[model samples]
Every structure is written in structure tokens, then in C-alpha cells.
Target: MKGRSRSTGLLLVISGASFWGVGGTVAQKLFQEFGISVDWLVTARLLTAGVLLLAVQFLLKDRSQVIGVWKNKRAAIMLLIFGLAGMLAVQYTYMASIHHGNAAVATLLQYLAPAMIIIYLVLRKQSVFSRQDFVTVSLALAGCFFLLTNGSVSQLSVPAPAIVWGVLSGVALAFYTLYAIPLLKEYDSLVVVGWAMVIGGSALSFIHPPWQMDFGSLSAEAYLYLVFVIIFGTMLAFWFYIESLQTLSPTETSLLSSLEPLAAVFTTVIWLNEPFGIYQWAGTACIFGMILLLALNKKKPAKSNDSVENEEPLRVS
Candidate 1:
């Protein structure tokens, strides 16, 4: 039974990561091929997914915690910050990256958050490096350089705006991973993430209303794609990931979640017919290697709570 459970968890985490990857491709199509805008999609996605996940949390998970965090003033403020700055920023910057570049590059760049987190910890004097940490940092930087510039230091093949957005996406993801820690410790991951979505959506809705999208211009397929982004991409992906964490450790889960970017690259190249070069492939391998190294050389990471305790709150949608 334990073997079967572990196998099931491996499958779930892989599928969840894969779904997130494919969903990004679908979103790219919505941006590149269709006239749909990122702001509109984000507003819709967060609001819809937020409501759905909150529904799940209330129905299947804890109900009181939904309202529980609000009773405390500091926690409530922190939740708002996490939602607006962390969740909304991460989602918006990521989609903007995809809007400017392909999903493959954007997803790969977002995966750089592990590197950013390491840098942040080092800056805060919270961590000291081992040989693997040095390797992880080197691989991450080299992977990013190759991925973005294809080994050219002076020139960038991808647009500069795209690269900027991608890097910002990574930074925002780091913030999300860090900011959600206290909230996750206090409440269920689902509860914190659900409300974060709602708060993020509500905040973005003020800037760009969800109801403002042109529904008439959208095809049935486009609508279906939107539904997939909201349901499968945002909601089920996170749900499956969090569920998988029940069986797998954070190190294992994080390593396996590298499948997210690989899946994005494959889907973007095969399904969307986006061009991917050999250098990009090597870069992807390097990034994946960093994750593998972390998992293998587990040294009680500086902030295990972000990954182990929270488990699945950091899904970059």
C-alpha cells in the first residue's frame, strides 16, 4: 500500500506539473493567436479559480480557517500583502512574460525562483553555502543566460521586455514562497491560497475588470481554453500538487515539479510549434539539474517551511 501510495503521488505531482505547463501554452495561444488580453485572463482566472478552490476548501477541507485568519489584524494584513504583491504580481508578471515571449522560456525563467530564494537568504544572512549551493547558483545563472541569450553575453534572442518580465516573475515567485509561510503555518494551504487568489483577483479587478472582456469575439474553443486555465490549470493543478505532498517530501516534490518547465517546453514546441534551440535545451537540463542536486543533497534548506510545511502554495500560474 505504501508503494502504491508513493507511485500514486508521483503520478499526481507529475500530472499537476504537466497540466500547469500545458495550461501556459493554452494561455499563450489566447494571447498570441487570439486577441484576448493578459489582464482580462488574469482577472478571470484568479476570481474563478479563487471561488472554486475556496469552495473546495470549505466543502472538503477546513471551513473555519477561511474566516480564521481574518480575526487577527497582522495576519489579515499579511494575507492582503501576500495576495496583492506575491500572488498577483507573480501571475501578472508571468503572463506578461508569456505575452512577450513563448511559454517555454517564461516557465523556465520562472523556475529561477529557487535561485532567487537562495540569493535572498544569503543576503539576509540566513544561509551559508555548501558545494551544492554553489553548483545550484552557477547552474541557475548559466541556465538563465543560455536560456535567454542562447550563450551570447551581449545579445539576447528573446525580447528584452520578455526577459525583464520573466525575471520579475521569478522575483515575485520568491516573494510568494516567502510571504505565504506564516499564513500557511496558521491555516491550511488551501485556505491561505484560496483567499490569496480572491484577494489578488479582487485587487486586479479594480484595475482591469473581469467583466470587461469581449465574449462575442471569442470562439467556443477559446472559451474552453479559458475554462481549462481557470479549472485545470489553476485549481486542479494546485489541488493535485498539494495532495501529492501528503505522501512526498518537499525536496522530492520540488525536484519532480521541474517537470512543469519541461512539459511547457515540449507543449510549446510540439503543440504550439514554437522554436526551441539546442542551447535552450541544455539550459533546461541545467535548471533541472539544480533541482535534482537540491533533492539529492538535502541539507535542511534554510527555509524548509516554504516547501515542506506549505507544500503546494507556490504554483506559478
Candidate 2:
């Protein structure tokens, strides 16, 4: 029974990560082929996914917690900041990276969030730099160098704007992961993430309404892709990852989650025919190695009451 449970967890995490990875590629296709704007897609995805997630929470979990979060002034303020600064920023920057470059590079770049989080903790004096930390940071920097330069420092393989957006996506993701800890501890992860998405989507709607898109320009296939992005990519991806945590250890789940970037690279290169250099592949390997190192490190610094293991939120974008 235990073995079967572990197998199910492995399948669930793999499926969830793959959904997120493939979702990015599909969003790239919409941007490149269908001329979809980042703002519109971000707005639509957040709003639609946010609503659907909240509905799930209402049905399966504590319904009061959905609106209950807004009742607390401090929680409400944090939620707003998380929604706009963390959620909206991460979503927009990631989509913009995809728009400017391909999904493979953008996905790998965003995975740098773990490195950024480590740096932040050290700077904040919350954690001391250990040998593992040094190795993780070095791997991340080396991966980034190879990824952007593809062995040539004089020129970049990806556009400057894409690189910038991708880095910002990583920063936003770090903020998103760190900031959500308190909320996750107080309320359910679903309630916190769902509300954050709604708040972010609601705020963004004023800038770029989801209804502003040219419906006539989108074909049936394009619409199907869009729906997949929101439903499978955003909602089910998060749902499956969170569910798997019930059976799998956080370390195992994090290691398996590396499949997200792998899936993105595979689909972007094979399905989208995006060019990936040998050095870029090396860079991807470095990042994957860093993730593995972090996950396997058993002597990690102790966190506060809001340890990441309490609620390991999956990256929705």
C-alpha cells in the first residue's frame, strides 16, 4: 500500500509539473502565433483560475476561510500586497518573458527563484551561508551565465528584454513564495492562493480588461489552448501538486517538481521547434543540479513557525 501510494504521488507530481511546463509553451504559442498580449492573457488567466480555485475551496474545504481572510485587517493588507506585488508581478513578468523569448528559457530563468530566496534569507540574517548554500548559489550563477550567453559572453542567445523579464519573474516568484508563508499558516493554502489571484486579477482588470480581447481573431483551437492554460495549467496543476504533498515528503516532491522545466524545454524545442544550444542544455543541467542539492540537503537552516514544509506552494506560472 505504501509503495502504491508513493507511485501515485510520483505520477501526480509529474503530471502537475508537466502541466505547468506545457502551459508555458502553449502561452508562448498564443503570443507568437496568435498575437496575444501578455496583459490580456495574464488578466484572463488569473481571474478565471482564481474564481475556479475559490469555488473548489468553497466546495471541499472550509467555505468561511475564503472570505474570512479578508476579515482580518493585517491579513487583508498582506493579501493585497501578495496579490499585486507577488502574484500579479510574477504572472505578468513570466508571460512577458515568454512573449519576448521562448518558453524554455523563461521557465528555466524563473526556476532561479530558489537561489534568490536563499540569498535573501542570508542577507536578512535569518540564515547563515553554509557550504551547501555556496554550491547552490554557484550552480545557479553558472547556469544563468551559460543559459543567456550559450558559451559566448560577447552576445546573448536570448533578447535583452526577455532576460530582464525572466529575471524579474524569478524575483517575483521569490517574493511570492516567502510572503505567502504567514497566510498559508493562518488559512488554508487554497484560500490564500485563491484570494491572492482574485485580488491580483481584479486590480489588473482596470488596466487590461479580460473582455477587451478580440474574440473573433481567436480560432476554436486557440480558445481550446487558452482554456487549457487556465484550467489545466493554472488550476489543476496547483491542485495536483498540493494533493501529492499529502502522500509524498516535501523533499521528494521538490525533486520531482524539477520535471516542470524539463517538460518546458522538451515541448518548446520538440513541439515548438525553438532553438536550444548545447551550452543552454548545460545551463539547464546546472539549475536542475542546484534544485536537487537544495532538496537533498537535510541540514537546512531551521525556519520560523512558517516553515516552507508547512505549505509548499507550487509555482502556478
TM-score top scorer: 2
Off by over 4 Å in 1: 1-3, 301-313
TM-score of 1: 0.94
Cα-based lDDT at residue 190, candidate 1: 80
28 Cα displacement, candidate 2 (Å): 0.3
Question: What's each prediction's TM-score?
Answer: 0.94, 0.96
lDDT on C-alpha atoms for all candidate structures? 0.84, 0.89
Question: Candidate 2: misplaced stretches above 4 Å?
Answer: 1-4, 302-311
The worst-scoring run of ten residues by lDDT in candidate 1 lies at 304-313
Task: Give the alpha carbon lDDT tens digit for every residue of 284-317 in model 2.
Answer: 9999999889778745445565355435655678
lDDT of 1 by residue, 45-129 (tens): 9988888888888898878878888999999999999999998999999999999998998998998887888777777766766
* Cα RMSD, model 2: 1.5
Clashes of 2: 0
Candidate 2: Cα lDDT at 82: 93
